[model samples]
Target: MDPVDYVFTVRTGDRKNAGTDANVKVILHGDGGRKTDKMKLRNILKNDFERSQIDNFTVKKQFKIRNIEKLELWRDNFGLGSAWYLDYVKVRRKDKDTEYSFPVFRWIPAKTHLIFRVNDTSLPQQDPEAEQRWNELKRKRDSYIVCQKITGGPAQVIKLYCSTSLKGQVPKRK
Candidate 1:
C-alpha cells in the first residue's frame, strides 16, 4: 500500500533538562516539492523533576507525505543548553501497519538532521544493463571454477587463495 502520512515518535533521555522542549522539523522529498512539518515541544516539566518519579517525556508528530522518496528529521535547538539525549525515533504510517524504528542511542546536537531513504519495494524496473552485467559475471565465475579445478591442488589451499583474491573483485549491488 502507498504511504499517505508519517507519524514520528521521539523521546528525550533526561527529564530534568530543557532539552525536551524543542522545535523539530521534518522534510519529505519526492518527485514533487519538499514537504515540511514543524513540531513544537513545550516546557511543562521543570528541571527539578526526577526521572523515575514520572513517565518519560515523549513528543509525537504526524505529517502528510502524499508520496515521498526520502525524508530528514531535525531538532532545531537554536543554541540551547546541553545537547539532547535521544533515545529513538519511530516512523509509522496510517495505511500500513509496518513501523520503522530508528535507534539513535546518542546525543543529538543542534541543527543536525538525520536523513533516511524510503525503501520502496515496488520501484519500477530499470534498464537491463544491471541484469546483463550479472549474467556476464556468472559466466566468468563458472569459467574460473573449471579452470582452477583442472589443476590438482590441496582443497584447503585452493579455497584460501580463491577467497582472499576474489574479495576486492565482487560487484556491489545497488
Candidate 2:
C-alpha cells in the first residue's frame, strides 16, 4: 500500500441502462509479480463472485457496504491469449453449523488490514458507464490500515497500507 502505485476501477450507477451491479471487497495478499495481481483483480471484479469471512466481527468504524464487488488483480497489458481472468468466485458463508458458498462478489482478502483501490483514468478511451460507476465507488468507499511492504530499489522499500476502494465495474472483457 505504498501510495498505490496503480489501481483498477470497477464501477456502476443509478442509470436505468446500468443493469445489475455489485461491489465485492477482495483481499489480495500474496507474493507475485504486478501483472498477476492486477489481472486477478480486474477479472474477478467483472465476474460473478463473492468473498466471505468467518464472521469475525472486527470493528470497522461503523461502516456498511451498500454494494460489494470481488476485485481480482489484473494486468495493464492483457497481451496474447493467456488471460486467466476471472471465471467464478464464491463467498464462503456458514449457517446452522454448516459452511456454504454464496455466489456474491464481495470478495474478501485472504488476510485483513491490507487495502487497495481501482485505478482511475480521465483519458477519452475510458468507458462512459465505467466512469459513472467509478464515480459512485469513490462517493461511498472505505479503507483500512494494514502493514504491507512495497518493494522497489533495495534501499527504497516502502511500508504502509496503501488502501482505498474502487467506484465502478469492469467493462465486458474484450
Candidate 3:
C-alpha cells in the first residue's frame, strides 16, 4: 500500500455535493473558539505527522466557496432559551424592481474539516479555476466533507452521496 498522507478539509454544517448550497459565512471567533483555534489546527496537523503518513505535510489550506456573507447575531427567545443566528440577511429593494423584503437565512462561520489527500507533489491547479482560488475555497468550506473512520482493513470500495433537495439542486434552474 502507498504511504498515507493527510489532506485538510474545513467542513461546514451543511452537507456537500457538486450542487449543494453551502451556507457560507464569515466566522468570527467565539469566546472559547478563539483561544483553541490555533491549538486545534496544530494538533490536527501534528497528529498526521506523528502517524508517519507522509514525509512532510502542509499547514496553510482552504476550500472552494460558492457564496459568503458577514454574520450578524439575531436573538430569538422561545420558551426555554434564546437562540442566535449568524447567517441571515435583511434586504430592501425598489418596488419597481419587484422589491421583496424578507430575512434571507444564511450559514456563516461554518464547521470546518482538515481534509487530507496523498500525493508526491503539491496539488495541481486546474487552468479554469486558477484565477478564482478564494471563491473555490469558499465553496469547499460551505461543503463539509468528513472522512469516515475505516475501522476494518483496507477500504475496498468508495461511495458518493448526493442530495435530492430541489432548492440547492445543481444544473442551474431555468
Task: List RMSD in Å for every model shown.
Answer: 14.0, 21.5, 22.1
Q: lDDT of each structure?
A: 0.47, 0.27, 0.25
Q: Please report how far candidate 1 places residue 20 from its true position, in Å.
A: 3.0
lDDT of 1 by residue, 1-174 (tens): 232545555555654453533455556554566554554433365441122222222334444455555556566654445446665555566566666555544455467666544542222245223453355456445534322322353322223335555454442221
Candidate 3 overall Cα lDDT vs. reference? Answer: 0.25
Model 3 alpha-carbon drift over 4 Å, by segment: 1-90, 94-97, 100-106, 110-174
- Candidate with better TM-score, 1 vs 3: 1
TM-score of each: 0.40, 0.17, 0.17
Model 2 stretches with alpha carbons more than 4 Å out: 1-72, 76-80, 93-174
Among all windows of ten consecutive residues in candidate 2, which has the lowest summed lDDT? 52-61
Worst 10 residues of 3 by lDDT: 48-57
> Which residue pairs clash in candidate 1?
none
Per-residue lDDT tens digits for candidate 2, residues 22-93, read 222444332332211222233422332222211221112222222222323322222222212222232221
